[model samples]
Target: MKEKKQNAVTALLEYAGNYKILTFAGLTLSAISMLCSIVPYVCIWLVARELISVLPDFYKVLNVETYGWIAFGFAVLGIIFYFAGLICTHLAAFRTAENIRKIGMAHIMKAPLGYFDNNASGLIRGRLDSAANDTETLLAHNLADIVGTIVLFAGMVILMFIFDWRMGIACLLSAVISIIAMFSMMGGKNAQLMADYQAAQDRMTKAGTEYVRGIPVVKIFQQTIDSFKTFKKAIEEYSDKAEYYQGKVCRIPQAVNLTFTEGAFIFLVPVVIILVPGALQSGDFIDLVTNFIFYAVFSAIISTALAKIMFASSGIMLASTALKRIDLVMKAPTLKNCHDPQIPKDNSVVFKNVSFTYDGSSLPALSHISFKAEAGQSIALVGPSGGGKTTLASLIPRFWDVDEGCVEVGKVNVKDIDQHVLMKQIAFVFQNTKLFKTSILENVRIANPDASYDDVMRALKAARCEDIIEKLPNGAETILGSEGTYLSGGEQQRIALARAILKDSPIIVLDEASAFADPENEVLIQKALSVLCKNRTVIMIAHRLSTIVNADKIIVLDEGHIVEEGTHQELLDKGGLYHKMWNDYNQAVKWKITSEKEAL
Candidate 1:
């Protein structure tokens, strides 16, 4: 626990260190601003003291006019100081908040993908926003509070001592005692409250994202009430945490500190007034009273400042935790051994004794997998669910590196090539099509931004997307909803295929694009694939065996190992695992056709 706390503090310091100059400037401006706050109180004290003591002396010395001018000058100077501090304080606060936000966002962008996946976007947003709030509050309130309190208290103590040492000693002792009590009462409780609040916030954020993402599924199944139940529980837990912390941890301690500090001043003020007169002159007594008044005001303000600091510090702790989560993800070691992979000259990929296990998993997804596909040839991966077919395809893109062996393209280790360069040589269409909210043109353009309008049209035609395009209000200019919600599964798949076709890379990977297509859509996709596969190397994962029956080669996998490799006819002739899967698939297809005919 101690180590964690230290690490948290270190991370905060590191994050803040980037804005060292700005922080120092803020602190300096804050001190200057608070220093100005003392001007009014000091002037008030000086005026009261002189009125009680200086007027009579000045009249006796025959200098009434000069004394009047001197008092007027001091009053004007005091006002000037007060406004100067206010201006500086606000300027510092705004500047600091703006700078921190800009730097924090830049850091977030530099962070890795895993960081974003591991942490909730809301929590990250919360941290940046809260940090900005804290910075501004610290400057606008705590800065003035702390500096004003210190200057006022110090000035009061000095004046009191000049009047009488014994009274100064009493006031100093009381101030020290008050500070200790405040920290002891609230420090630990605030820390725990902040930690709990942050955890609750993250849970709520996660649940909200889940609810939004699953809303379509929930509504289709009439599961809205069940979803609400889960959401309600999350919200209730979050509220409970907030209420518990507010009552027990934050507000109570502040109330206690304020009551005790104010109450102490009441008792201390009278004691000083009663005891100081015996040891001082008339002017000295007035000075002592005025200083006591200053101390009382300073103490009240300081009490509030400390409470606020405690609260803000707790928020800072929560922010630090969020930042640490981001840091951990950004620091996760990417797969190494990549130095300079040779770009593919011909479209061929080879997996040599490849093995891989996902992070924190005990079993390998693919074990000792070896396969070869020549230039412009298609290799179909056929297997049961969880048979590592998708995993092996992912290796081609270096999504996750092979744990034990080499994955090569054109006789060069993929790890040695920069991902950017390697990606340019290949195009991938995943099982789940991902389309951003944008115009159809923009979505297809992502694969090759430099592709001309004619190129886009040709790719669209080849991918069998012209029919979907023609139905749209604006054709290629039509804006799609997020993840292409407006399009059917087959339509979206064809759009994705259009994108790959637009890319025109020599190597192409298709992960079950036909898995969800009906007979009509399937026929369209098959036609599109035939055109797209021309003069390109293709590796496809297929659940519908018929789609890949004519693939140049087919590899059958089960339990992380390839059980057989042969052409479709050759595999059937062997009468092994492939033969059985193919037979079952044929029977299912025939049964579906016969049932449809009978119904009609």
Candidate 2:
């Protein structure tokens, strides 16, 4: 079964939920207001009829003042209704936008953590926050205007033929031409161009965010804006899209639309001239003049109505594109939870014939791989870059689900375990640690929210962060990444270790945790690792071979396959891939030492 495609207005109304009633009420009121507005024009015709019937005997026009007051009253009533309609729409529009943002965020929160790696935070925020704002204009003002204009047009059609059909046809011709021109700008291939223009805008927003985030790198490299090629390209693409849509696509159609829309009375003058001889022959020149006055005044509203349609149509297209972008974020894959979740019996982790590939990729990141880290065992994964070390580590946490086979903890498949329970069993510390801009106490307490202040203090002490805390003014209460209280990369790494220590999970997955630390910090990080790894089933990935030489088991991976697995000394004796990598690492370390001494 295929799903029914909803129009933009209908899709947006879904987000309104209970507020949809307000939107309907607003449209109804707007239509009634438009009908009321037409009464004044009818009154003008009646006033003209009375005055012309008495021809130069102006005082004989007894109903002229009555008609004037009626026109004034209807005009005032129209304004009040219009304003009241706007109030209803504005309230609904605000709630609709709020719901869009709230629903988008809630959906995104359920998405897998790995999704953020491919989708930039800026792009997601722009889609949810800014795109929702775009829809507000459509719902608040454009929708009401559209409804009012439609009602006005329907009433105009009936009134047009009532006086003189010929004059009515002439007045309607301009509106017909204007409608055609407006649709030409929005319909067919041009609709696709508008969508492309919006896509380019999204790309520019994403690129701008990436450029801003990389500004520090740019400054460090002494580079200019031109050096940020992606941002520059995105800007150029957006400009080109805007230029092409406005200059090439919309230029002629827009001109035609505006010319016909504003000049709706253009055809009325010639039609009245043609009808003059017949009126004179029928001795009804007074009627002709009166009907001409009515049509002429009515033509003015043709311009207002057509202009509303043009802008309203534009709003519809913009909102439709915005909803599509929101859909992209909402469609992100989320980790599926088992209905009957099972708890793991033990801390032992095992992989059985596991093979996984990233989305949109042909080759597997890990192929037919099997390994185990028994409770309290330390297993180190070491290999060249892109050897599936990080990918394998990520699988244990179900960052990306496996394409084949299963990962088990305590003999229970990870997919069968409750996501929250699974997360509680393992703690991960990556090379690039992220700390929120909050107090140090809060940052560490995130790992174990129920843990007491004393427990956090003990974890920090165990992670060898005493020196870091002592140097700060407020100790654990000091805010990080603000007020000049920023920690060095190594210091941040130690703090991350403290977080993991506070978590106190039986399984710890460390991915190049000390890769960015300076030599002094490296020593401190190693000491912290010792405390963290104690009595835990540790799965460590490291480029620094020295750190993992003493592991109970070392696994060497290459091109998604495990090439060798054994104790470090046993692998060294075997002279396999691990042995060769160890030799290369030793040569690099010796070269670094000699280079430093020579430089001194």
Q: What CA root-mean-square deviation does each model show from the true structure?
A: 5.1, 2.9
State the lDDT of candidate 1 residue by residue for 1-600, as single tens digits: 235435644454444544434444544554544444444555555555555556566544434345555556655654565455555555655765565566667766544333454556666765676556555555444444455455556655665566456545655555555565555543554555667777788778778877887888888888854566767688889999888777665576556656665554664566676868663855466666666665555445445544555554454455456555555434444544355456666678999999988778899999999989998899999988999998888888777777899998877788877677778888988777888889888899999999998889889999999889998888988899844439888888899999999998889999998878778888998898888888899999999898898899999999899999999999999999999999899898788444766898
The total number of steric clashes, by the backbone 3 Å criterion, in model 2 comes to 0
Steric clash pairs (candidate 1): 338-415, 339-416, 340-416, 341-416, 341-417
Kindly report the root-mean-square deviation of model 2 from the true structure over all alpha carbons: 2.9
Model 1 accuracy (lDDT, Cα): 0.71
lDDT of 2 by residue, 513-537 (tens): 9999999999999999999999999
lDDT of model 1, residue 85: 54
Instruction: Rate residue 489 of model 2 by lDDT.
Output: 96
TM-score for each predicted model, relative to the true structure = 0.80, 0.93
Count of backbone clashes, every candidate in sequence: 5, 0
Q: After TM-score superposition, what is the CA distance of residue 386 in candidate 1 from its true location, in Å? A: 1.8
